[model samples]
Target: MKKLLIALLTAASLSACTTTESFVKGADVGWLPQMEASGYQFRNRDGKRQDALRILKDYGINTIRLRTWVNPSQDKGSGHNSRDETVAMAVRAQRMGMRIMIDFHYSDSWADPEKQVKPAAWRGHDFAQLQKDVYDYTYDVMRALQSAGVAPEWVQVGNETRTGMIYPEGHTDNWPQLAKLINQGYAAVKAVSPSSKVVLHLDRGNDNQWFRTWFDNAKANGAKWDVIGMSYYPYWLPGRPDYTASIDDLGRNLNDMAARYGSEVMVVEVGGEDDRPQNTYDMLVAVQAKVRAVPGGKGLGVIYWEPQGARSWSHYALSAWGADGRPTKAMDAFLRQP
Candidate 1:
């Protein structure tokens, strides 16, 4: 049945629109999974994962990226998030035949460009202690996955690590320490699953200097990785509203990085839904068209970020965006991709 689905997708790709030129196609194309992805942020509830996995499979998604934190709710006025929740999600997604990727934030709370708060448990640790903390955290996570039979195929050492992770001590400002911590995460992942592809990710996919600088420093200090992943959202990235130019820049930048770092690239997170679903969808389709046009861009998949945010479920008309929200135009963009 999967084979047949692949054949049908292949035929559809060949004949679907018949306007855009086919850049390349290999035997791996059929076996290659189409990336129609979304996020499944859970509240540590049991038995909900089965339904979530079913929804993903029904949506033709084949990959699941789960985020892990050391301890999300140990502080006052803070909420709780558990690795057990993430592992449960991975197990369910795997049961549904979805490829798994584990995102190690190496922090207690949300780890993004703006936030990289160290886990309370690791605070006040020296450089050596920080390295040990990183290794133990990563190892323990992977070990938990292995013991629970939920090993991920890909392991991301950190989140949108724009300025490095485990800040102050191992932040990007200190390449020496940042590289050390990153290397520790890399070694830990390899220790558990030698075959898993380790991905080193960053924000600003279109920024030549950002990618070059980060990877150059990382490579110089021996940051092992199998993939150069990025997070691109035109709506949020610092650039003009010229989406076409932005995507064209993405292609050129990615090609440059591929040549420089010798790694496969993936846009691990994306999607935008403004005030209107139709307009959002239109913007997304145009963006997706340009994104898919990137050279060697066939396998590049995107994960819709919080497409179904909490407040927008029923009366999505909270303020500007539409009340009727589901996949939105951003999703339509993916549907129209090669």
Candidate 2:
């Protein structure tokens, strides 16, 4: 009887683990609230007006990614991802039964490989104070979400920090400082929401060597994170190579990052040109396939960056929405079986 009970318990443990792992189909809709506020209506393929989030959910997006900026400008084209806005959006998405991923840009505006400008409030702070700022800001945001009954499942410490964040202060040239800043954000996230997985993101998902070099340095400098987040944008890649030319590399990189670091990996951002819906659809399908193929279920998800930010309003070409306020065929890629 004891032996049989032990076997059953072991099986239950394995089953629980399996059940906890889910392949995330997510979209970064940081611009959504602004879009809606600007009277941008979203419609399904059938042309009936609908809530943007509902349209996304109907297309199989189970998760919503929101980016929060520090003291963001109130500009029409480039604002409105503030803490209050993020919390409200998360609450709305949570109420809709969608998971949330909070991306901390740690800047007043966009933070990416090309730029990681520090918020104006943190401008003159020395390294030590900057670290404290990162922690306090992260903790405050997490606490706000918690107070609003929204707990993000994944919290990105920084967005696309290939050269590092916070400009000259946290640049890759000072890995030690950057690592400390990352740890501060990670610690704050865990302090407020213990179950939230911290993500460290970088651009160039298909470049295995770049990932290796960046992560190796991060590891050496004691940067802690739960997931390796990557941005894969073939549309922006130099010479604009087709997805076929580099998808295998992305797959290999995903597998390698997982095996090498014992951490889950996610394509946190990916998008193709909006004008080429079929090509974008095929690219998204292939990207999801690559992520799902990662060994040991280490590929957590793929997120479309600002998919609903229609080209008409945002002038960005990578969105999956058409000028007519309907999702293009590219959005259907999420419905494809893995």
Q: What would the per-residue lDDT of candidate 2 be over residues 1-53, giving only the tens digit for each residue?
A: 99999999999999885552378999999998888888988899899999999
Runs with alpha carbons beyond 4 Å of true place in candidate 1:
1-52, 74-80, 239-242, 279-299, 313-325
Candidate 1 lowest-lDDT run of ten = 25-34
Write model 1 residue lDDT over 35-128, tens digit each, in one string: 1122333221222333433433343455777677788764321333357767776776677666778888887767888888888998877889
Query: Clash number for every model?
Result: 3, 0
Cα deviation at 15, candidate 2, in Å, is 16
Candidate 1, residue 164: the lDDT equals 85
The per-residue C-alpha lDDT of model 1 at residue 264 equals 68
* TM-score of model number 1: 0.76
